[model samples]
Target: MLTYYPGKTFLHRLDPTLKVLFAFTISTACFVFANIFVLLGILLFEFLLALSCGLWKWGLRSILGLLKLCALLFVIQILTYGDGDVLLRLYGDWVITFEGAEIGLILTLRITASALPLALMLRVTKPTALANSLYRYLHIPYKYAFAFGMAMRFIPIFAEEMAEIMEAQTARGVELDTRSFFKKIRLLMPLCVPLLLSSVRKIETATISAELRGFGLRKRK
Candidate 1:
């Protein structure tokens, strides 16, 4: 699970605001430095941080997905932003240029470095603690802080619901994993109906519960 895991790790013990500041600092640094080596170092640091927090598996999964995105970005960047010496020839006049590849690699590294810290922070920090920290330290409105926490908590719940829906569909002979792109897309269409209905039901229930609890009745002091 990518959600918070109760643990005795250093990251788990850190102040929520401090962790948020650290993530912001690292993300800013990633954008500031265009050097590939610096970005690689930051990337390595993120992996090490994940390992220290016992979230290496989740981090690895995120990295794998990002890598595929980076590969596609590399192609797009090379084709659209191609300049300087040609690196590789494609069909006809198309070619991958050195400048394009360089820019693509840098952008990919920057994105990875920027995202991993926040992901790790959220995975380690409980949403309630985060909300409390925002309310206490940052003096944010209680309703907004609580809403942020609830939103974070719902992410994994929705993912689990979607997984269950997929499994049920698979058992009923829906071929969601088909190689044909359009066929797979067509198969996924049925999933939207159930997901949308469930989402609407959840929203309604939440709204009613919030009203009963007087969510916005009293303003934060």
Candidate 2:
């Protein structure tokens, strides 16, 4: 499924440079503030922006994915270097410090709070528009920017293809998850071989077609 949703919301109407700057400003502010209230306000702002853009569902999905990363960092922080007064004394001398836990919680919250607005901007904007904006306002090289834009457009297709490959393998009784870690990785060899071979052939065909069409004979203005 495509992660992007096309819409005519205010966010979509805004200049891509401004939208990018807006996300960067919020992210920077979130990193600078240690106060949880300020961070919460940032989160609220992100939610409001997403809602206003009419991408509430898409934004929520992105937020949920972000939450997973936040949870991982929280767990790692709680488990390591937990110092100061013990909140709950677990087995052994391990102690979950109030300061450490508080810092961890704030860090995790800041991460999710910061990620939402960026995700909203990316989800609402088209890659071509974003690249064109960068080339215009940011003075990025047009060829490089367009290539990056094309790469971004291919991400969803690659993800979908991966999912289909996994499902097809599962249907064919490939034990993808039941093997040892190394074995599971080795099993990927079969998948990668075919995908790489097909990709190489496709790339060759595309290159030949472009050469015949005189793609680079004249520099594009």
Candidate 3:
């Protein structure tokens, strides 16, 4: 689920620290620019740079996902707190303020603009490279860094397990068609229980292994 593709893009060539700095700088600019037009200009520039790095399709898809999430949030905000001018009053008196709608839109755009480039950076940068860069620049402990690396690696493992479990249940004539949402959810409980148990066991084993290996020991030299 989380793997990097090798490429000769300039982003791939830059030092990891520089790439992170660039992402942080862009994120800061997004927050600092209160005007939507200026924030959009920065987002457009980021899109161009992402395209230059040979990941245009990936970047665009991620940005679109952000847009959808933001749109959903805006809808919820309008429905719940919308008042003044009265864009269809619901249940009586609860109104969506024009100011509130504008605030929501600006906030959504700012968050999306800030997050998309950082995500793109993650997509292009490998986990090992990121961990090493963090260790070198931020003085992060290797144990914690390696744990983060392992956690990212496990995402696909758990996903594959879930898919296999779903397929097995489907083969066994378990109708998960969701005609009854609650029933389908109940069926998922069995799968979830075992998965949770396995995850707990894995965590316990890792902790014990770390203890045996003197993971907390500092170098005497």
Candidate 4:
């Protein structure tokens, strides 16, 4: 779940704006250096920080998908940026260069390091506190802040709904776990229809509720 977990940890006690600043600073600073060692250090720091907040397990689980994505990006970078000292030569001049691999590794680490801090913040900090901090400290409009928080809160809900839908379909004799990648994609495509319809219905209901509460017309000082 992306929603905050109530805790008495130091991270939970931190001001939302300070947490946002720390995440933003680390994420941005990660790109300022191209060194793999520095990126690794940042990644280590993130891991330690997550552990400090008692979120190491959740952080690892959350980042598994991201790790796969980073791996894919690393492969792409290695293939596309192969213009340096040859490390391993493949068939027909397809060479894996040392420089390319180094760059790919650094990029992957940087991306992962950049994402972890913000993910940790979202996991530990309440959405209402985040939104209020954004409105008060960052001067962002309260309506926009509320929408952002709601979107974050809804992500896990939508994911759970989709999983339930898939399970229901599987129970009804639908084969969704085929080994063939394309077949899996084809099977999954139909599931999106129901998810989209449900999302639209939810949006309609939320909009009507907000309107009833005069959410847009309320005056702010």
lDDT of all predictions: 0.87, 0.79, 0.76, 0.86
Question: Which 10 residues in a row give candidate 1 its minimum summed lDDT?
Answer: 74-83
The number of the candidate with the highest TM-score is 4
Q: lDDT per residue, candidate 2, 1-221, as tens digits?
A: 23567889898889988999998999989999998898988887787788887867766776677878799899888877567778877778887788778888898888998877777777788988999899889988776776667667776866776667777897898887665867777777789766667666765776678669874575646
Off by over 4 Å in 3: 80-94, 173-190, 201-221
Model 4: lDDT of residue 144: 95
TM-score of each: 0.91, 0.83, 0.76, 0.93
Residue 93 displacement in candidate 2 (angstroms) = 1.8
What are the RMSDs of all candidates, in order?
Answer: 1.9, 3.3, 3.5, 1.6
Clash list (residue pairs), candidate 1: none
The RMSD (Cα, Å) of candidate 3 is: 3.5
Comparing candidate 1 with candidate 3, which one achieves the higher lDDT?
1
Report the C-alpha lDDT of model 3 over 22-76, residue by residue, as the tens digit. Answer: 8999999888888878877887888888798787887788778788879878877
Q: After superposition, how far is residue 48 of candidate 1 from its true place, in Å?
A: 0.7
Candidate 2: regions farther than 4 A off = 175-221
Of 1 and 4, which scores higher on TM-score? 4
Supply the TM-score for candidate 4.
0.93
